[model samples]
Structures are given as C-alpha cells and as structure tokens.
Target: MASKKKRVKLKSLSQGRPPTLKPLHSLSSKATRTLISSHHTLQKLRAKAVAEGDEAKADAIAKEIEERGGIEKYQHASLLGQSSDRGGDSSRILMDWLVPIVPALKQHASDGRQMRMLEIGALSTTNACSNSRLFEMERIDLNSQAAGIKQQDFMTRPLPNDTKDKFDIISLSLVLNYVPDAIGRGEMLLRTLEFLKIPHHLDSGCQEIFPSLYLVLPAPCITNSRYLDESKLEMIMDSLGYIMVKKKLSNKLVYYLWRRVSFSTKRTCFKKVEIRSGKDRNNFSIVLK
Candidate 1:
C-alpha cells in the first residue's frame, strides 16, 4: 500500500487574506534588532531626563529623536510590524479600500506611462497594493526580510524624477502612528507630497482624475492624541491640495481615501471655527459630519 501523503494545513482564506507569515521580530535581521535596541536605550534616557526635570536634556533627546526620524525610528516595521495593529485588520481594511479605487486608476499608458505605486511600510507582502496588480510597484520598509521589500527610509528618499507622474497611487498603511508627534506627522505629509500626480489636463473636463492615497493610521491620532485629530488632518491635507474621498474610524485604525482635487473646490467633512474669549481662548466650534 502506498504511504499516505501528509498535507500542510493552511490558515483560513475565506476572507481573501494573505497567508500569515512568521512574527515580524523573528523575521527581522540583525541590523533591524540593533536599531530597535538603540532606540529603546534612547527612550529610557528620555524618560529619565523627563523624570529628573531636566528640561534641557529632554529637549536634546527630543531633538535627537526627531533627527533620527522621531519615534518612527524605533516603532517602525523594524520593531512592531503589524503586531501594533488590531488583529492585523489593517491589511483587510487597506485591501478593501484599494480594490474600489482600481477602476479609478488611469487605464492607458501614453508615452509608456504605465501605472506605478509606492507602498511604504509594506510588511512581508509581495502584492502590496493588491488592487493595482498591473502597477510597477515599489515596496519599502525598515524591517521585515520580506522578498522585494527594500530596507529604505521613505522620509528622506528623494521622490522619483525620471518618471514624471509615473505613480498613480501611494499606500501608507499603519505607518504614520510610528512618528513621535503631530509636527513630525505633518512633516511626513509634506515630504510625501511630491509623489502624487496633479494633472494640468483638468481644463479639458477629463473624467480621469489624478492619483490618490490609501492611508491608515492609529485611531488615537484622530480621536485622542494630543497633537493629531480629524480636524487637524483635514486642515493639513486641504492645505496640501488633497481632500478626503472616504474615511473610516475603526476601533483601532483611522483609514482615509484622499484624492487630488482643486483646492478651491475642496469640501472638508469636518469644519470648525476657533472662537476666542476676552484676552483668552474659547473652545472650537463643532460642526460634525
């Protein structure tokens, strides 16, 4: 009798989820571990400085942290990967957000303008933007020895130049939460602004619009974080010539779909007006969407 073949049991795929990989820490390289260790050491020093009421020392540490890419240097994929996320629901949320936008992507390639995309903080996945399969994808991460994921810093990397408006979309999923503060997060938005395509052909009433973003950040950023909230984000993105096309504040994550639109025509879902008291400050006006 022929020996029975042993089969490998697989995780459930009924929801079209990516196969679960080994934990990110186990898959991290020695260099990743070293960075994480250094970051933690700095954190301990920072805490001690704060406890000692050494304002100068704390400020110095904060400056150093900012120079080293803020908390992102520490909490990046190099350390937590998707583990910081809620049951790793980020992947599903992003995939769902991305799939619907696929049809909105530019279809034809004039002058060899094939669709491309940048996936920052892509954790151990080949198909970073599962929606744009035809896109010439580039994936970057500080950790995760995933095949094709380059260990590169997205903050400092120069935007693509040779291909003018080559990329049609960028995905920054569960990455912004790693930044230390609101200013750092705003700086991130500023740095990544060059990646989008703002077509001048809008004068022709072309139904085909430019590129957009599928962003996922921790919910605290929108709900209770000291520096960040939905109102602030809207103001920043509006100033940058983008508007939120869709949004979801889930239990663990705040997801947004932002597409390029004319600044004059932008409609912010959340609106507020700051009213000040006599030589003092009044709370902001609330017009909930």
Candidate 2:
C-alpha cells in the first residue's frame, strides 16, 4: 500500500546562474497590465482564426502588424536593448557612421554585368533608378521586408556569390545612420563592392570595372539638418579617388554623383565641369565634349 514514490526532476542553479524559481508578484504597472491583456486577446483571436481556417482574418492581422509600425519599432527596440544611444534619427545616425568609408567602396567595385550596383540601406534607390535609363539598379538592405531587397547583414555577412560583377552603380541613400558602429558601416560598403567583383574573371573576362557611385547625405549648413557636409564629404571622396561629377540639394537632402577619376574614359565624360583660372579669371565649364 505504501509502495511507490515518484521522482521529480529539479533544475540546477550554478555559481553564475540566478535562481530559476521566484514568487509571482502583483506589482505590474498599468502599462504592463494593458500590454499583457492585449497580448492575450491577440493570441486568443489568432488561435481561433487559425483553428477555423480563417485565412482572411489572419492576413488582416498580419497587415495590422505592419501598418501599426510594429516592425520598425521592434528594430528600434532591439537597437536600444543593445545599449545604443543613437536616439530616434536612425537614418542620420547611419549616414554619419558611413561617410568616412566611401573611398574604399569606390576602389573595389567590379564591372562584369551591364551594371554593378549595391544600394546600401536603400529601399527607394531601386525605385529611383527605375526612372534612370543609364544604370541598372540593385537594392541591398538589412530589412527583410524591403521589396526586391537582398536580406543580408551588410556589417557581418559576406556578399552573395551571385551578386559579383552584377551591378554598375552603387548608391547609399540615407542608410548609414541606422548602424551603431561607424567602422562596421564602412566595412559593409567595402564588402558590398568586393562582393560585386567576385564572380568575374580578372583580366580577359571583365577586369571588374569600378562602378560609379551616388551618395546622398544631409546638408550641414542648415540648422538641425540631418545631411552630411558637402565640402567635407567631397574631400573624403576625393581622397578615395572619386571625383564629384554632380552636386545638388533638395530640401534637407544633398546628393553627390561621384566617379573614380582613374577609371574615367573619354566616353564617360562628366555632364558639368568647373574650371577656375588664374587671378581675375574664374570660369564655369559645361562639358559639351
């Protein structure tokens, strides 16, 4: 009668581990209670819909997750959790981090396909390039939801083998600000260009021609501006062997079209060239030749 005894498995708490069991507290604040209630309600509804095979309701909930800024907010929360103090301006933060590394990207670009392009942090660059007849566009982003985007961590992951020598233009539009590390952001650009040249044969095949680059940053002269300083940015590009082919400002945005001067051929002349002569002689040249 007094025969059987059952064994219960217990979890171990080691020297470094915190205790697993604790008394539950009713100390949750109003916001915590509301969040718990909402989460439970959502779980119940989702479970009901799934059980009934209500595809439409499930789809609506999915859309609501996106429309309510859930994804962006989640990404932000993750960044904050990692101890980043960059604050709300993710785009500007990424730009500041990336501006210093533009030169390396210009040097390593490869030309195997009709155009080799690597768009950094851009979902809109592809849309913009759709309007341009000159260059084929390739959109690259860390965000998985970006349309036609290749999902890869530009900072850590190597570029895909298939993308080598596949692009002609590399555009980084409002991307660098989101990354917390400045060097990693720069390295991402370099890695992207390196990835683009990997598939091509070096000599007889295509020499992996460096592609032209377009960098858009925030303007410095304007107060509370998120844009990069044009003069300083051009200096950085110049050091990297990229010459400023075009400069334009729209609202808070500053765009610079740069091409590697060493790669310049007679066939690829700039649309506008500025020439300054000696004393009492300053001229603006519009390149027609």
Candidate 3:
C-alpha cells in the first residue's frame, strides 16, 4: 500500500500583515535518531490520542514531530541517508526552473554583480539552482540540525537593515507547506516581501524589475487550493504589486516565478492583462498593463 503525501497551498498575501507563527525547534542529533527509530510508535500514540478525544495531546505530539524536523527534514539532513550533493545536481527534476531568467543572471555576472539567493527551509539540502554559476547562495532553516545552515525564523524575522544587502532571488521550495492555514501562509508571503530587492527608481522608457521569487510546491497544493492556482496566484500577487512571470505544473510538483514590479508599473497593472502559454516551456507568461 502506498502512503499519501501531504497537501499544501501557496498563499498570496499583502505586505501589511504580520506572521504570528511559532518557533521551529530541532531535536538534538541523538534525539533525532531516537525519534526516527520510534516514528511508528509515535504515530500509533498520536492516533490513539485522537481516538480518545484528547485533541490537545494529539496536537502536541504532531507539533513535536514537526519541530524535530520530521520525515522531510530527515530526508534533507546532511548526515542522513541521502547526500546533499545529490540535491545540488543540476540534472535534478525541474532543474531549469530558472531557465527564463538565465539571461539576467548572465548579465549580472558580466556586470561583476553576483546575484544573491536566499533559500528558506533549505534544511541540509542544497537549494534550487544552488549549483548555478549565476548566484551566491545563502540558506536559512529553522533548525540548526544541519551545520553551516544559518538559523533564522522566516515567519518573524525583520528585514535586513542594510539596503545594499538584499537578495536578487529568493527560493521557497517546498517550504510554505509547513504553514498551518491560509492566513499563516499569506503572512509568510508577506514576510518574504521584505527581503525582496525591488528598484525604487523607474524610467519611462523601461522600468527595471527587481528580485524575483521561485516557489515550488506539491502539485496537489496548487490543484486543490482555490486561491493558489496559476490564474488566481497571479491575481493575488498582482494585488500585492508583484507580477507573475511564469508557472509550471510537473507530475509531482508545481513551480512559480514572480518578478517584483515597480509601483509605477503596478499602477498600469490591472488595466488589461493577458495570460498566454509559453511556446516550449509548458508554463504561462503574464503580460501586465
């Protein structure tokens, strides 16, 4: 019998909201080993608790499992079964999620400006395009279980104080699923906006776009959630002043690309927009007014 994978939705949020998420706590290495070994028993206990009408007990068990960096985190740990190098491979699934923006990366390299990338919930695995020659990647995970990964809580952390130290790309691959609800997911997106590097200055001839977000999630999350699909996602993000550049749905996962549009460009956004599929990319491109 096959086990079911969890479903998660990608939320669109306004920048004004605040994240009230709880802290993520990682178990010690020994504790993690014990947890992994006792996973079945824990599940059984959780099930019994649920059956006994002890909702509080069930929730506590579930939160403990999640905070200890559950199955997903174990699969990503540096010292675990799979090596992180495999995750760094460019041939991995959806490797070209950044393909359309390769030209921009090349241009930045030519200008001696390295594109900065932030990978949230990267755990011990390499982030999407971490192997790319285009950017210098920095990772943050709620758990310090993995060495060399910074400990940062994305839900509540304030934006960096230095203006010159913003990232050009932020990847939240498979991370938003951890959020509990639509509002929490929306709040996470709101927090994400602070780290984006949008250009304040706009030229009449051509407005320069800023940092873009790369989001990947379980395919079901997109299909099942009313507000998280390609069309609705673009609409939601548009309201928040970002334009959806591309969206792709693969067999196991979904991908989204969003470029930060300037305030001036946003003024013209809702006028007349068209969604047309890309010729060979199997994704849709949005033409904003």
Which of candidates 1 and 2 is the stronger one according to lDDT? 1
Clashes of 3: 0
Q: Which stretches of model 2 miss by more than 4 angstroms?
A: 1-113, 124-126, 131-136, 157-166, 188-210, 220-228, 262-289
Task: Name the lDDT value of residue 140 in candidate 1.
Answer: 81
Q: What is the C-alpha RMSD of each candidate to the true structure, in Å?
A: 16.3, 20.6, 11.3
TM-score of each: 0.58, 0.42, 0.59
Candidate 2 lDDT over residue span 1-289, tens digit each: 6433332211110110111222222223443334323432443344344344565665565455444333343333333322323222323332343344434333333332334456665444324344332334555555544566676555544446565444545666544333322233343334434443322343331232344466654443212322223443454455445667656665645566665544222232222222322353322111212
Say which candidate scores most in TM-score: 3
**Candidate 3's TM-score:** 0.59
lDDT digits (tens) for residues 178-205 of candidate 3: 4433445555665666787765542231
Off by over 4 Å in 1: 1-86, 89-91, 98-113, 127-132, 162-166, 200-209, 262-289
For the record, the alpha-carbon RMSD of candidate 3 to the native fold, in angstroms, is: 11.3
Flag clash pairs in model 1.
none
**Candidate 3 lDDT (Cα, 0 to 1):** 0.54
Report lDDT per candidate. Answer: 0.54, 0.40, 0.54
Candidate 1 lDDT, 224-260, residue by residue in tens: 5433457677776877677887788877568887776
